[model samples]
Target: MPANNLRRIHSLDGLKLVMVLCIVWWHCMPRVVFGYSLPDLGARCCEVFFLVSGFLEGYRHGLNYKFTFEELWLKAKSKLKRIYPEHAFFLVLSILVGVTSGKEWAVLSDSNVISAICNALLIQAWIPSFAMQFNGLSWFLSSLFFCYLLTPLVAYIALKAKRPVGVWHLLVATMACRVLLEAECAKHPDIYSMVNIHENPLVRLLEYSFAYYLALVYRGRLGADTCSKKVSFLWSVVECVAIGFALYCVVEFNGAWPRWMYTLVFSGVVVIVAGERGILSSLLGCKPMRYLSVYQMQIYISHAVFYSLGWALFPTSSVMAHVSLFVLIVIYCFAVNCLKRIRQNKPKPTVTESFYF
Candidate 1:
């Protein structure tokens, strides 16, 4: 199928919104829920975000026959422009919150100054000590920016393969490399800090690259065709099984499995959901879910700030405080989205009007 003719995968948007909420819950209170560790489950959810990002990048690359450095630069710039503004806004907000609340971590020391610099440049994730500086969760954006810059090279290599199996081979090799790194980290826990293993661009990039290759494979095999009734039924079953396997890994395996193993499971979930033929897919892609997804990024980026403020204003252990904080975050995100839309839709002045002004 022609890439230009491909339909939008609305279901992925809904999935993203769901993951954003899970991340918020994890950050607010990292605890076991229904036998699953929220912290570990949150890590898996973050992996899914990386996978979704890479898949979209590869899928967009499929729309073109040629790849060039200029195109790569443009894509990187586009992504940075989209993410950096919000990141900077929240970074400043975090600093203010820290100052007002007299948070020790936000104190201005030499190390902290360096951390601020790194965060400003979106390179905090590359520095283990500085990874959780202002707006700690911004480290995800830092790592994601690194992946965006590499998309051109990754896409070129994947496209050069000329076959889905070849791309799969690349993905397998990357996964093997990730597995070895995970083993090394496991062997020397003292040497590798949590930030080093989790927020390292080099480590996270493997997961992103794996999904990029998987996206190419998906395009080659599925090609955006609408499934017939029988095929849709089969796809629905596959989708359910894929989701079930993912849940099993999160619940049953929990922290026992390697990160790559969970990545593979979540990758299957993404592929199955992207098929858009399943009953679950239809339900997830419903209007309400799609509408809520518009604020997914805003919610993810700003929720930490709200949590910080909530801590200052309310008792940390109070259930009502946590609920109130979550609600306030949602309302703030909604307002932000509304303002963005209004700005985007506002009319531009004509040349004569601008000259008069």
Candidate 2:
């Protein structure tokens, strides 16, 4: 499908907002919340992010058959430009926090200087130990940047596939590889750390690649401009079932299932949501939900700083304290976004002003 002909998937924005909140909740709340395991929930949420990102990338670039290495460089640069500013801002903030608090676990220590450098370069996830250093959540940015760098290759592969079945084959192959790796890790246990498996760029690239193929499959067979009432109702049923299965795995399985299973379940939800043919998709794609989704990235990056500081200052186990801290973080994210808009809208000097004596 031509890019111009494709409608914007507003439902994705709402889904991203939901996932971001789940991550924040995992970070702030206790392990088990109202009977669900936050860790499992957070893990799947992270994968959802990767899948969503990959889908968007493929949706935009996969059909560009002429994509070249130069264009690939430009794409990588564009992604870096989008993400680096907030990443740097948070990194500096974390350093200042460490220095000001004079805490024993300060990220500014001599032992961590290299880790800080890796974080600065957005290569922290490539190094297992450095992945969680400084702003730990920024490891997502690092792995995502790696995936963005490989976009051209992924898009090229997607374009080469002659049929939807080819895309399915690619998706299954990638999942198989990931499952094999997981099994290897499980057998050795010492060969690869859990952090490595979780934050490794190679592992994440596979997940991202699977999503890319999944996007192609969506474009080929699922995405449609219109649907009959019966079809929409059936889609709604599928969406609900997908959500229920995903949540059940997150809750009942409690991380027992292979990671790829969760990815497949999440992909099902994503494909349906992207269709926007279902009642749930309609609700998700509403104006208010789309608006809230704009600040998801800012919230994800900055929440940890506020969370850590709140704990340090209050040292409380109160549920209300956690709620208050989360509320403060949201407000801070809104303010930051407003300031960014103002800066972007500020006028620049005219060309005539460049003249000098």
- The numbered model that scores best in lDDT is 1
- The number of residue pairs in model 2 that clash at the backbone is 0
Give the range of the ten consecutive residues with the poorest summed lDDT in model 1.
Answer: 348-357
* lDDT tens readout by residue for model 1, 1-357: 665566667678788888988888788875876885454756888899999988866765653635677877777787777888889998999999898888766898988988899999999998888888779999999998899788777877776775767787888888998888888888987877654767899888888888888888887787456432223788889888889878977888877877888888898899888877888888767778777677777788888887887776775566766776788777876576566557668443121110000
Give the distance in Å from residue 78's predicted Cα in candidate 2 to where it truly belongs.
1.4
After superposition on all CA atoms, how large is the RMSD of candidate 1? Answer: 5.7
Candidate 2, residue 328: lDDT: 74
TM-score of each: 0.88, 0.88
Report RMSD for candidate 2. 6.1
* RMSD to true structure for each model, in Å: 5.7, 6.1
Off by over 4 Å in 1: 30-39, 63-66, 188-195, 226-231, 315-320, 346-357
**Model 2 misplaced stretches (Cα beyond 4 Å):** 34-39, 100-110, 193-195, 224-231, 316-324, 343-357
